[model samples]
Target: MMILSWRRRRGGHRTTKAAFSEENLSTNLAIPTHFLCPISLDLMKDPVTLPTGITYDRESIEKWIETGNQTCPVTNQVLKTFDQIPNHVIRRMIQDWCVENRARGVERIPTPRIPVAPRDVLEICSNIMTATQRGDHKKCMELVEKIKRWGRESERNKKCIVENGSGYVLSALFESFSSISIEEHKFLLGETLSLLIRMLPLGSEGQSNLGSASSLRCMAWFLKEKNLSSCQNAVLALKELLGLDEKHVNAFAEIEGVEEALVKIVKEQICPKSTKASLMVISHLISSSTSSENTISRFLELGLVSMVLEILVGSERGMTEKALSVLDTICNWEQGIVKARAHALTMPVLVKKILRVSILATDLSVSAILKLCKSQEGGGDQQVEALQLGGFHKLLVVLQVGCGEKTKEKATELLKLLNQHRGRLDCFDSSMDFKYLKRPSL
Candidate 1:
């Protein structure tokens, strides 16, 4: 990294280096651009090569890794490890240049500290658990902060934390903090649960440690926090746990306040991340095989149908997909069908969503409509309302155009139901001509 100094002038002329003595280059020396690290854009004091074969100054690269970047700054290649190998030749060259320019005011850069070792991380985790056992909440938080920082520092550090018992320690911390019933400890409990969520990639063993009912309660408590980060992380952690196994999903059904918390979060629309996470939590609950009945019943009791319709009417494609998915699940149950039909916007939103958002939305929308219209013979007045609302035309267009097989089947079944009641009205089989179809106000 010994850089030659070349000064660019107004006319693009570089001042000659001939003015410099061999003993001291000018401190005002314009460093060569290549001599700078790609990330920090400063001289490479301790250069290191990533797996991508690109080099960066050690501190900048380590900070990037600590911030959870998985790719090289220059090449954008996935880094196998943040364990960067030192470019000794570059370091020596930088030192020599610094020595040469010492008389001119350039100071030599100090070497970087060594990377944290796995044994040290293990020791921290061991200390964390011991502190927790001794009821040392203050020391526990300090230890947890250390582990959190280490985990965020690099993927290697995260793996080390999980392997060195950080996950279990965090889980135990969650359990202990949640059971105390102290108001002040709530913040610490939320933080602990948040850490558990950050370590979710540790897979089944890590997920299992978080399966306690007390942990779920801790998340539910977080849902009530004024802090948006805590709420969002709690939602995310719940979603992650539900995704891990059926037992976990079923466990959610037993949690008394979670369904209501999620509904409130969705209705509040705090942020896109929290709303999406809350919707996903509801989706998983409804879609789970063993828990669908109980989950749907509880959601309906919480007036989830009305809240979902509100979300669906104005949501974008992503929200629409999840809303429709939950709606589709709800529509299959008798209680759900009763609630949906009772909702004023359910029919119109269902009709409007078909072919309006995405194929997945279309599929879920079609399934919901089929269930609603087919629940009774000729779908009763629902069929007439659908035809009057332009749902008849939408179903026909669904059949005429491209869609998935299940969507097509549901559409055909719905069309037959609409046709069964078509004779009652002056409606026509105007599947081909768009001009003949009168759109409903809804």
Candidate 2:
């Protein structure tokens, strides 16, 4: 046997033996080679033997398998099965060694919890359905808590839960409880939504169950909750559910306070993810042919135009694109155009973003500016503002740098519109580089 010795640092918190210096190991007592995991070279906390007759730490081997490899680490042979068997004898020896080396600063590893099995997840889902059918709120809540815990325990556990059909049961429960006032079952609803959020990319049946009007109302109610987690999950779930079908988009538009809640989420800037989800929801609603006009008016009344302009000023590339996309959709309506033109930041911000962001952003910016310029009330004024703010130069650059075909058309039309004002405005400078032009303060 090879003998190795290392001085353990006092009060050190390192987990792997490899972290220790080779110089420190020159004079320490020998540790059995079998005691260390082949993968990590650390003491095995939960030793298990593979089908290849190789024993390694359970976590290390499981991680190796999870990363898409199918071969035994040491044997370099194809694994017939990924099942791992607990090596109780090795675990006992390792524990005894730790006890014997307590004076050397070695700590004993505690036994690891058994991983959740598929049968365990199936039993929980069956019980949840039973409890839900019997009106046993207490039992249902308890089982839901267990499912939440297991889902959070590991990626494997979450996959097992989803594959075992927990999503159907949870969706049914959510739909059933949505008809009741939120205050009556706040905790139960909140927990169920949290779990459902984890099991996303829900199946068709699950999405159908959650896409009902009442369920959408429940999601809107959760969006108004004081708890940030509930708000985040609610909006995320709503976005997914709405995406299942176009009819759900129209239904969501009719939900009381749905528009308000989404707008408030965007305005408050709760978190970036929630904000993006809310924007997507809004986009769906506004794009729906059945409810486009009503949805646009409602969102405009909710002050969406100003909020999006504020976002465009400081947000990053992805978010800026979304905000502009929403803006462009809103500008499709005359009311949307009027509201956007009325805002102080509308012209300057739109002109500033013309060529600065991505090609998609340039497309949206040009489209929105074209709509604003077409506004009969302020058409000439917007054109003059575009001229003074170097809109003429930016439009020229858009044609040069390349943009979408439609954007190209809009750019050409906008160039003609701005050119009409170029001779009238004394501040128009064709020779000035757009980069050096001073943008108006927001």
Q: Top lDDT: which candidate number? A: 2
Model 1, residue 130: C-alpha shift (Å): 3.2
**Candidate 1 global CA lDDT score:** 0.76
The C-alpha TM-scores of every prediction are 0.72, 0.86
| Per-residue alpha-carbon lDDT of candidate 2 for residues 132-223, written as tens digits (9 for 90 to 100) | 88777789899999887877777777788888899988988888777765678888989999989877878888888788777888888888
Go through the candidates in order and give each one's C-alpha lDDT: 0.76, 0.84
Query: Which portions of model 2 miss their true places by more than 4 Å?
Result: 1-29, 67-71, 74-78, 427-442
Residue-level lDDT tens digits of model 1 in 18-67: 54453453336656565579998878877888777887887788789889
